[model samples]
Target: MNNKDMKIHLTVDVWAAQKADARAVRFDVFVIEQKIPVELEWDDMDEHCLHAVAYDAAGHAIGTGRLLPDGHIGRMAVRAAGRGKGVGAAILKALMAQARQRGDAEVVLNAQTQAEAFYGRYGFSRDGEEYYEAGIAHICMRHVFS
Candidate 1:
């Protein structure tokens, strides 16, 4: 389907997993689908971070991401069915908005090698050498804005 045919909803909440259906989407895409260890998939910092999810017109969560007070954006996930539909981009944009609302000057993320170009589209620039995280090659990226 075309992006214009898709509807994206974005929100930030303290209960990161209150949207069980949405968190399931993250689990499927990040853990089970990508073979990432469940233990590494989550961190204690979630309790303090702002979580955002993108829902489709029918209300099923299609994408998800989070923003930490220090300007870190993490746990971005898009369901397989939502891939290529601009869901990821919408979620990232929401996270950046949250950062700006909190007066952050920049947002940072460790993007998977395959997704570097995707983040680049949102103005994130590669900042360091590649490294391994959760058994996947990743690069540090940052988006600076006024």
Candidate 2:
């Protein structure tokens, strides 16, 4: 871990109280930066997923991701200040840990193609053909526990 990672704080929580921080990070990264339609950025799944939020040293939420009951991880987003700082990694780790703790066989995600390599670094491999969602190219990736 780098300096940023050392100072980053992470929490795993339900959507009820973590939605505000998680929503802010997702909105800024997906809706604003990526130009994804706000309607497509949110769904009922959020209310049922276990969320992981990463905060900077100052306690500002900078990254967020969630793990669904079925072992699917999604909605990962990191703001500009958190990019390349291990914020996304921290969030992803927390969500995957949550899934593992719940006895999930594997954790899966539809990763934007541009981020395929990032997921690969964590042992996630492509599991399907490329597809488009909200005009962004993506490929399903999965990491099965040993």
The positional error of residue 108 in candidate 2, measured at the CA in angstroms, is 0.6
The residue-by-residue lDDT of candidate 1 on 1-146, one tens digit each, is 37443676666787546457556877999888999988887777777888888888788888888888799998899887778888888788878988998899999999999999999999999998999988899999999995
Q: Which sections of candidate 2 miss by over 4 Å? A: 3-6
- Backbone clashes in model 2, listed as residue pairs: none
Global lDDT of model 2: 0.91
Candidate 2 lDDT over residue span 1-146, tens digit each: 96756468899989997999999999999999999999999899999999999888899999999999889999999999988888888888888888888899899999999999999999999998999999999999999999
The pairs that clash in candidate 1 are none
Superposed by TM-score, candidate 1 places the C-alpha of residue 81 at a distance from the truth, in angstroms, of 0.9
Worst 10 residues of 2 by lDDT: 2-11
Candidate 1 stretches with Cα past 4 Å from truth are 1-5, 16-19
| lDDT on C-alpha atoms for all candidate structures | 0.84, 0.91
TM, every model: 0.91, 0.96
Specify the highest-lDDT model's number: 2
